[model samples]
Target: MTTSKITAEDVAAGVAELVPDAAPVEVVRPLRQGRSHASWVLESSRGWLVGKVLLGPAGTAGLERLAEHRRLWQHGIAVPPVLAFTESCASVADRPLTVFEYVPGVDAEEALPALEPAVVLEVMRATGTALAALHQVPVEGFDDAASGLGTISATWNTVVTSRVEALRDAYRFVDDIPAALVKTGLDLLDSLAEEVSPVARPAVAHLDVYLPNILLDDEGRFRVLLDLEHVRWVDPAMDFVKPAMWMFPDQQSWAEAFADGYRAAGPWPACWSERMAVATGLELLTGVKYWTQVADHAMREDYLRRLRAWVRSDGADHVWSAISSAT
Candidate 1:
């Protein structure tokens, strides 16, 4: 909801300072503003590019995210390479600014709904394969910036528990969350947390993997991945959480196809079902809390509806279950 204070002049100055060679900025058109950052499509003498200005508290984490993007690119993930980054660009809204190579494509969120079912299946399968490659990149500690338990944790258990505890703590003050739902959520978290064993080894996970983060071309083929800011080292199953929750719950065949593609590339661990269930439950709880905090009643109500359904089913009505049944 925070509007960007960045102006065309600011963007031009940023381009001149950070990417002097790409100067003589011809166009600076604002793109959709995200929750934590404001972005613009920039056309310059060099070529087209995307510039992002970190907003609010997200400014401090720019360097760390830049490094993560570089790591993913080095490992062959289709993330756009960072061209230039600055921690403090006083002329550019006095916030951290990063410019990246502009990838030409539409986000799958906008493209998927219009595609033929068969093509949609192929896209989902390709997405599954792409995620497999992403998770193969080995990583050490878990870094969840939003956890508020610190930037990095030694174990995935710590991160997961911290998130559950945070939700439980919020239950006291968030009057919007139903008491019965909260109780069920807490109990489910405790039970599911126990069911999910520790991951053998951490791999890179795009913690936010919903349709909006996936890019596709004119022909509906996967082009590039977007939004590497939330990438972390965690259970590979965690990568499936968002898509499982938001992307494929109603699309059972898509889930099965994704599972097929994933199986072709790597081992589909037996624990995947439990892991996805618990992670999705926790994510729903977080979504309820977030929407309530932002006072978005419509979204809060939607999240509550989904959470209630999840609770009614005892967390079994999830994409993983759908995929398991079909497989």
Candidate 2:
């Protein structure tokens, strides 16, 4: 459920248990950290790899992720091949762990601004190509058991309503939730849920597609997509919301290049772009509670500002203006 507090001794011992006589075991913290799992680099005769310790019990999510990793690899996505997966462990501080090949490439976060402009373009193009292939995967089933398989929702709207309610409930634990904010969120969720047309089954998407998760080669070409913990079968539009709302707003040319590469590999539905835009607005509004309550107070204002800006975005601008006037 969170990143573990792991030590070199624990990892070394865990590695030994996973593979007898697996030495000389060396564990080092990675330069970049993940949100839910503490990642470490493991160096041994077997090969250089990364080990992740899930802070909480693995249960269904951990096992399901291993299966999904295999499936993604089978589909030829540029993801790290998972080497070892285990839920229970006596040697690794009694936590669940997954080990995979340590990508030998530069992280996009490190290479983006410091590198030449051409390099960033290369990264975008490669990322687009991989995303195209990833989206090609057919929707096997619906609903998220976290692994993208479990109950099926006939309509995405049904799922949206449920999620909005869940987010609202989660805000109860927030330190100080103003009544007006809750009312505004509930109203937006109601209106947005009504606006979406019925959609086909969900698609396999990398729920988190930020630049940090993407790795680039020395030339700034995307090589691997990492951090595959929460990937699931969800709204196809969910995948592009980040790029459309965040990435595109920052770099117009880079976003266009990525878009061109994606379109070249396969056919995009005429409405896919519109769906993504709507999803962006909906996601922004829904996430406001989490940002304000769960996140650090320092980030609260900036997060709320982004959400307010989203109100002025494509499909949301007019609705938000009316709400503003009414209030």
Best by TM-score: 1
Model 2 segments beyond 4 Å from truth? Answer: 1-5, 19-24, 145-148, 312-314, 317-327
Tens-place lDDT digits, model 1, residues 21-111 = 9887655577667777777788887799888887754444557667777888888877787888888777675677888888888889889
Model 2 root-mean-square deviation: 5.1
Model 2 TM-score?
0.84
After aligning candidate 1 to the native by TM-score, how far in Å is the CA of 84 from where it should be?
2.5
TM-score of every model? 0.87, 0.84
Residue pairs whose backbone atoms clash in candidate 1 = none
Considering every candidate listed, which one attains the maximal lDDT? 1
Q: Write the per-residue lDDT of candidate 2 for residues 1-327, one digit (tens) a residue.
A: 113456766766676677654567787656466656777788877788777777777777668767777689878899998877789777666788776777788778777888888777767777877887887887655464233455567666666666667666766766665556555655665566556646434667776776888988776778888777767666666766665544555576677677667777765544554455456655665556656655666556654565565444534442112211112
Worst 10 residues of 1 by lDDT: 141-150
Query: lDDT values of the candidates?
Result: 0.74, 0.66
